[model samples]
Target: MIEQLQAFTDSLPPAVQWIVVIGLGVIPFVESYSGSVIGVLAGLPFFVAVPAAILGNVASMLFAVFAAHRLRGVVRGDRSEAELSPRRAKLKQRFERFGVAGVALLGPLALPSQITSAATVSFGASRNAVILWQTVSIIVWGAGCGALAALGASAVT
Candidate 1:
């Protein structure tokens, strides 16, 4: 599985690297695995993989946050518009109740990384706060996975 993933990443051209990074970063499972695979394929050390993955993940999170903000405007419509629709109100309420941790961790598991990050931001969570927690989570998870894959690769070789 690891070798196959590595080969796929390695086959991609340099121009495709950014695309892969963004695509994997926005998605859920791919964000969790693609960075490590790319690192191994590129002949980068595990330490490098961890940071690269974290950066990709962070970029995705920022994109989501911006999207969520834009969605809020769309949902709210004009200032002259009376009140939020039932669905919009419900979403706002849910986000308000769940708070940052809900979106930061559980959201990623349930939805795409971008959606999760954006939802958290749309709910009026501080951007810095969300970024801090999400970055930490991404780094920790990416590092652990990268380290494990590197160790396994070394053992097999």
Candidate 2:
């Protein structure tokens, strides 16, 4: 799947390639980290690829956070209470222990920024804080992965 995406990205005109990279970055599972890797592997300049990926991912995550914040407001007004599933129970436990920053930074290992940001917002974390931390995480992960992929591509060439 990644290889196919890389081929597609590589086929684009150089002037607009970063746009496709940004689009890739907006996907859920294929967020900034994978987008950066794809962009770098597809021969985009590192400066263009990493920042584009981060921008797209952050945009998507911001949408999720805001939507979740609004949803949480509506849900909070309701009287219903439901038990957490086992998986959700575990996630809640981690969130309780780690707080927003830790979860934002490490959540990418288990879930994309969109899901994680939404979840964090649903759990009643401050929306602005989630945005700040998630942005930091996106940039760090995107730049780091892009750098590694660039190094590997250079080595192979």
Candidate 3:
């Protein structure tokens, strides 16, 4: 799937390719880290690819955070209806165990940042705090993954 994304991105003009990267970044599982790596593999520069992916991911995440802020009241109003599924239960447990920073940094390993971020906010975590930590994680993970992708691509060539 990522290889197909790479092929499709490579076929577009550079500006549109960035747009494609950003589009993929907005996807929950794709996110900035994999989006940046896909961009790098599609031949975009690391600087451009990483930032574009981060911008898209952050934009989508902000939307989710704000949406969660509004939905928190509704969700909270109905305790019985809001009972978590086992997956969400585990996510909530992780949030309890790790807090925002640890979850922000490591949550993607288990679930998309979107899911974790929303879950955190639903648990009454500060929106601004979650956004801040998510930004840091996005940058770190995107850059790290992009760098490794570049290195691997170079070695393969």
Name the top lDDT candidate.
2
What candidate 3 gets wrong by more than 4 Å, as runs, is 1-11, 77-94
Tens-place lDDT digits, model 3, residues 64-130? 8889988998767857636778887876776778899998999889888888788789877899999
Question: In model 2, what lDDT does residue 35 have?
Answer: 91
lDDT of 1 by residue, 67-99 (tens): 777777787566542466789778878877877
- Deviation in Å, model 3, residue 61 alpha carbon: 0.9
Q: Where in model 2 is the C-alpha error above 4 Å?
A: 1-11, 78-91
lDDT of each: 0.66, 0.89, 0.86
Rank by lDDT, highest first: 2, 3, 1
> Which pairs of residues clash in candidate 2, taking residues 3 or more apart in a chain or in different chains?
none
TM-score comparison, 1 vs 2, better candidate: 2
**Best of the candidates, TM-score:** 2
Of candidate 1, the 10-residue stretch with the lowest lDDT total is 17-26
Query: Against the true structure, what is every candidate's RMSD?
Result: 4.3, 3.7, 4.1
Which residue pairs collide, candidate 3? Answer: none
Stronger candidate by TM-score (2 vs 3): 2
- Candidate 2 per-residue C-alpha lDDT over 1-157 given as tens digits, one digit per residue, 9 for 90 to 100: 6566667767878768878889999999999999999888877889989999998999999999999999989877864436556786787777889999999999999999999999998877899999999999999999999999999988877
Taking all chains together, each candidate's TM-score versus the true structure is 0.65, 0.85, 0.82
